[model samples]
Target chain A: MAKSNKPIVWSLFAGGGMIAAFVLPAMIFITGLAVPMGLLLENALAYDRMLALVGNPIGKLVLFGVIFLSLWHAAHRLRMTLHDLGIRSGRVAMLACYGVAGLASIAAAVVLLSI
Target chain B: MGEVMDRRPYVREMPKSWWLGQRRYTFYMVRELTCLFIGAYALVILVGLFRLSQGPVAYGAFVDALQGPFAIAFHLLALVFALFHTVTWFGLTPKAMPLRLGEKTVPGTAIIVAHYAVWFVVSATLLLVARA
Candidate 1:
């Protein structure tokens, strides 16, 4: 039997799920609601501060990991969801789902590096 | 063996709306659906990152766009979904990874409470840092 690549994708999916579960709520609340609604400092996400955050190596790594893993996690979940919804074209679904995640991960890496 | 091979096995057909048949099934579907919001929110952050790299003007515009009515509504919905994911994920963690304390296995409730405590600390730290 050929080796299955399931473990690699599953690891990414699980890691992403872990990150999404733990930090995503607070991250969303902070960036989406609090900052925009003036619940945080008026300049909480000001350009300078944000630039400084992204400029730091550790910050870049964290952002990259969060974005990368979360995308993969969503991609895998969506693929399974599509199957549950009766879209049984497994190969096509796998390509479309993982393809999007792959491209987005590259985009995130490129953007982070440029910053 | 040949006679046995000639016989076809019966297969059960699942209805299209199977998930809707049970409350737990429906909840499970909703839980799965949260990924859409999570994926979307991540993409939004990705876009913001790209804009930030573009410079202050671009980043400011991105931030401005986030405050619009549609953006606000989406974020509000995403926030709720994210919270749901967090709750459900924490609840499942005990089952996913049972902790061992030497000779005895730790109680599931203890594991869940520990997760919540860590989540609280992490969220508080993020808020403080962002506001600082």
Candidate 2:
């Protein structure tokens, strides 16, 4: 029986929007290097083994927090996306979007626990 | 002509609420899905970075897998969505975060324009550096 509210939705939207803003510049830095590095120079940064950095406390914290919150934001937006797409049948859409997001959050938690 | 049954000329206009009907709903869904794709692109990057920080061997495996066709296609699609999302998201930012100076409220359009100006400058600098 939760009430639907625009402000709540927008707040989550804005948070996701902020994450989007942060990611683009970062990707430009990463892929901009990874592409050339992987293709031309054969840099190790192109590989996932560099995930050794995640063992660091700061890295672990950031990764877990980002994964958890971003997924939370994603679930809400995905539900809204379905609704906007003319899936006026609320129950089905909610189950799908929320189900996927819930699984993602659980995986994130496991990753954090292992770290 | 009046005595004839001409049903062709009696068409009615669509209802006003049709703006909120199926077509508009589909458009709205597309817009949000575009953003979701953008979000997915970012997550992949974050996950890659995390894996990289783990170990060189693991990172190498990721790079190898990424070279596959599916990975490349996803990247290209994500790039398109990210660009679209950035444009639309910034267009909404001023509405999300309004700035007031004295009596005047800053407009969303101006804010979006300013963001583009900055994005252009930064991208230009990066290109110049890369070229050098």
The ten-residue window of minimal lDDT in model 2 chain A covers A41-50
List runs of model 1 lying over 4 Å from the truth.
B1-10
Backbone clashes, candidate 1? 0
For residues B16-97, could you state the per-residue lDDT of candidate 1 as single tens digits?
7889999998999999988998899999999999999999899999999888989889999999999998888889998999
Every candidate's DockQ is: 0.80, 0.32
- Once model 1 is optimally superposed onto the true structure by TM-score, how far is the C-alpha of residue B38 displaced, in angstroms? 1.0
Please give, for residues A28-89, the per-residue lDDT of candidate 2 as tens digits.
44453445335433443433333444667776776655555555566777777666445678
Q: Candidate 1 — which pairs collide? A: none
Q: What is the lDDT of residue B83 in candidate 2?
A: 65
Q: Write the residue-wise lDDT of candidate 1 on A52-75 in tens digits.
A: 999999999999999999999999
